[model samples]
Target chain A: MKPRVLAGLLTLALVPAAAGAASLGLGVYGGMSSPILNDTAGNGPQYGVRAPVTLAPMLIVEPFYAQSALGDVDQSFGGSSYTRSGPDVKMFGANAVFSFGEGVKFYPLVGIGSTKITQSGWADITDTSLNFGLGFGFRPMAKLCVDVRGELNAVVTGDTSRKFGNLTAGVSYALFGSE
Target chain B: MKNLRLILPSLLLTGLMASGCWLISGQFTVSQDLPTPLDVDSQIVIVGAHIDLNTQSTYRDHKNDLKDLADCALLGTFTNTGTGTLDILVYMTPAGSPLHSTKVQLDADATKIKVWGPLTLGPGASKKVGWDESAGLFNADGKQALLKEVKGDGDFALYAVGASAPYKLRLTDGVAVVVVDAGK
Candidate 1:
């Protein structure tokens, strides 16, 4: 897991030198993530931060961290009953972005990352997964851009194939080059 | 036409976002072993003990809504550690204290309502005993009569009964496991 996370970070570090980035930016966002299947669990809130490095007008690499809260569930076996709290999920990874427009950008991205899931009465589940998504970013003012995104993360595991949907909205502050 | 193509994907993404918990989080059937009062391994019990079901993380906010509890299971297993064969039973305790936790002798109390079983166990043996009518783990779909005894933060009493096992006195280890399918 350490190797994989390190590899992701290395990819972020090395992409700029290989492609020649035009700008560097920092982003923060928050929204709700619900079970994609609809039958399993309810929607929960999520928040995240990211560093987006533009390698070209159409290309960027983003390294990010997202934290989420999940809803609880209940069960009963005849006389015995229980309520299991929803697990909290934390993810760290990077995405390769392909931007479509300038100033107001429509981008689709794909990448991989590691995830850790935990709950009160259950054992923690940690795995790496591939995630892909789309985003629309526009500057409401100079040096600040409003960002909105929707993504699906497929957690890698041998036991069960798990995935989640995340939708977030926030702002990106320019660190250098472009806002 | 170009803008429409761009808007279409965002619309589709929004539709997926609104549709479901597509995040196939690998949360599976979670099972937890509950703790009992006077909880100890190989505890001696001729009478009964309150297996506290209230100590876990239960949702207090939406506890009243029945939909929140529709999909789940509770499983129980007990072991007899004595040298002789023994008979054991789970009974619903009287109303005030719990749905089922009697301090005194089980049979001596007139109001005891039987929940689980008079499961016979050989010396150093264990078996599954829940609301189900099965040989192994309980897959009971029908609610038990004493289901209300542990509906919400309630508990029941399990004790060795009958004269077949040394005046109903037996050294035993018992645990009830509550399981809920996260996939549902």
Candidate 2:
């Protein structure tokens, strides 16, 4: 993980404040994620934090930082063992979250950003990415909310891409300074 | 000699220039398509006509001189030349060694180092393949056992096994990029 990247993503979250956005929700999410093709890194847990700033009653721009540890890719033939450990991943992005309904909201999200993947003794890879997902948000109190989301994140380079799925649950609290 | 050409320059290659280290690279092409049996298991060997190691002067002269071998890699593509689909299992072996069949559920042979594929190719489709460090595990590359065999012997072969010979398929490719060395 690069400190500069983390700093950059954190900076994007504060952008909504200058616009005097209606509500700002700061939250943490954790869940299971696995790749869909050429699964080099097996399934594992992923966790992240997000700062979602509402621009309108139905729309929010969410900036997030997420990371995941990876499992080794192993194969054996004849007797020699070939082990390719992750290119483990870290991603930072912003999504446009569109909400539907009242207290219990349904949102479908789409976002784009960059990803960094590294493996021991090998070169690290950096690429562009896009994530698409749907989320259900529940509010038990006026300023506190709980949400569950299912997302497909794709890291693309040239004509090739690696895709993974993440399903996560999160809690957020709305701070003061909303319209 | 149909089409195997060593791509490395002979200038830097000597048994003792970097003292016993020869960085060799080459490509072999089979200009025609090979047909595979479709109803039962059948095998094809890429040998003398395609991978002519015998005629290449520098390659022939220095192969036996390599004392310690480095992890090498092969990179290329194979095409499905026929209209029907091709399901192929690829392996590298000491030339003409046979023992795999769609007939057997298991093959206990360790000499056959699988380098590529359960590769299925559609009609007129081409897919690239590569193998280097993982070529022969008979004694592992850096350990020097397989290096002795890879360097000393000629007629090293590439094998392809087809499962279920019901309807055959044709394959063609210029298997490009073979690199072998000593030390790292």
True C-alpha contacts between chains kept, each model in order: 0.09, 0.00
Instruction: Please report, in order, the local distance difference test score of every candidate based on alpha carbons.
Output: 0.55, 0.53
Q: DockQ values for all predictions? A: 0.06, 0.01
Candidate 2 residue-wise lDDT, B84-169, digit = tens = 78775555555533433432322445665655446677766866442322233213322343344445564454555444443233
Q: TM per model?
A: 0.52, 0.48
Superposed Cα deviation of residue B31, candidate 1 (Å): 11
Lowest-sum lDDT 10-residue window in model 1 chain B: B133-142
Q: Which parts of model 2 are misplaced by more than 4 Å?
A: A1-18, A79-82, A177-179, B1-184
lDDT by residue for model 1 (A1-179), tens: 36256547656665644445567788898999875532234578999898877766676667788888877654553345434466688888777777888778898877667788765523456776567789998988777889788988766443233567888898887788874
Interface CA root-mean-square deviation for model 1: 10.8
10 residues in a row with least lDDT, candidate 1 chain A: A74-83
Which candidate wins on lDDT? 1
Backbone Cα, N, C clashes tallied per candidate: 18, 14
